[model samples]
Target: MVTPAYRMIRIKNASSIMKIIGFLYIFTIASLVGRTIAALEFNQMMGLFTPGLYQTLSFLALFLIMFVGNTGFVILLKEQVDQELLRVASFDDLTGILNRRTFVLLAKQIIAEHVKKQKHLSLVLFDIRYGGDEFAILLPEANEAESDRLVERFRLSAVQAGIPEIPATLSVSRGVVTIVPDQRTTLETLYNLCDRALYDAKGNGRNGAARTRIAL
Candidate 1:
């Protein structure tokens, strides 16, 4: 989730940079004009230079400043943009859940650790039907407040339906949940059970929760 504080910081940085850029642009233009005028006066008074020579010198200086300043500014902007994009990509924007990429990586790590310890481990994959498309439609029709309310309701249902005995950790993406079980279950059995439960939830309708059972 993008916290209010972080958003504020981003806005502040953006505003500051825009102001700096604006000032730089104005200063550059003014300097160029002033140099041209000064050169023209010196040439007229002393006959040491021509208008073309003065203009060329002024243009080269202006072009160099523009090249360096604009290049640096563009690089900085790209870095900031990339950082923001990475943060957004790592989590679900709507429900503030960990995205699928994060879930997969976490699952693999946990599974490897459990295997080393000779403990049982399981993986459960869950999906909510049409959740992505449904949210896209709802987001425009309803305001963020309303959309949040809808997401919260579904999240609450899921949490309440979670099986406490399983020692499970869950990561949610756009419309999917991946559960990593600790010490208590076999992967194949738990997956089948959870998958069936998920199907049942889907059968009943969206916005519900279901869990797979451990096979004996």
Candidate 2:
């Protein structure tokens, strides 16, 4: 969803300007032709050529062209802006991971499917408290940039963890990493166990990984 201000700004792009200019140019030509024809007939009826008739007609045509072109340009540009905003708003800029909102949506669908088929899935939630908020406060100018680097480091840590290299589905927030393990263990069992493992990792001093066992 694009904010109104963003949409307004996108409407000011060069493409929109060019489009408006093109439409107005065509409108100007058509209006001039129509005005010239009407002026000729009106002058004939009055038996005299009006001094400023052509000038007045030209001004009116210009105004109409501007009005219609500007309206159309805003409509088109707003739509484009809205589409781009949707893409940006759904993505997490830090780790290039799916944002929390999108992840939850996906989780719902996965849960429903697993319920129907009696399959298992695992979720691991862990927080990395090392270099947390203090690091951010220290580098205020480059906060997001540093956060991105930190996220990459975390991803590397995840890869190094003893878990088999299944297609790693990972989501990271400020200091939290939630890993969705491969569809091997039941969701209820996996969550409970992995949650404990996560606490164990935290207890072992912070930036580490632990896995929970499913006893089925």
Candidate 3:
């Protein structure tokens, strides 16, 4: 039973506690094998081997198994709950992308890193007004041409991969802004420019891309 339980834990890629318990099961098997070999070779039970001591060890082992099982279950459940909460807080329920608040928080750090590295950064915004689906992509060390190519690739892929529920192919309009970020550059400024470019795409007619370049 312990062997199978350990195998199941390994197959499931269970928590650290479960893995530790599995290792303990292995230790138990080794000890049991060593004891059996000693008993068979000696042709008599060791003087120290008493039925009462054996019973005590068995009870202690059972108590340990119960304690570890219950405690590990609670720890695993708590970890699962924490991961769920983090997912719900950090991602959009509908789109499964980073929510606006989480993006803003992480974008600040990304902007700082890019600025320090003196690298080009591109921000792309895709807004489906009718469906209320929005996506933002940040490309570090990407120039205007690279960003444009990526935007076009995404648009073409969306057009080619038709949604199962929709009768027609998906139309994606994107706004791209590429810049060599500096200390003065802010995420809000980049976002506003990208949003303006998105409107430009919409004005030119949907299913298109508009790109802007900032010197700073």
All candidates: TM-score: 0.31, 0.35, 0.72
RMSD of 2: 13.6
Model 2 misplaced stretches (Cα beyond 4 Å): 1-79, 129-193, 205-207
lDDT of 1 at 106: 61
Best by lDDT: 3
Candidate 3 clashing pairs, residues 3+ apart or interchain: none
Q: How close is candidate 3 to the true structure, as a TM-score?
A: 0.72
Ranking by lDDT: 3, 2, 1
What's model 2's lDDT at 180?
30
Q: Tens digits of per-residue lDDT for model 3 on 18-60?
A: 6766666665555555556666785546444445443345455
Question: How many clashing residue pairs appear in each of the predictions shown?
Answer: 2, 3, 0
Q: Which digits, one per residue and each the tens of the lDDT, describe model 2 over residues 15-35?
A: 554454555565566656766
* For every candidate, C-alpha RMSD to the true structure in Å: 14.2, 13.6, 4.3
Clashing pairs in 1: 193-212, 194-212
Cα lDDT of model 1 by residue, 56-147, tens digit: 55566567557756875786688689878987988788778667677656655655565456543333344533353222111222323454
Ranking by TM-score: 3, 2, 1
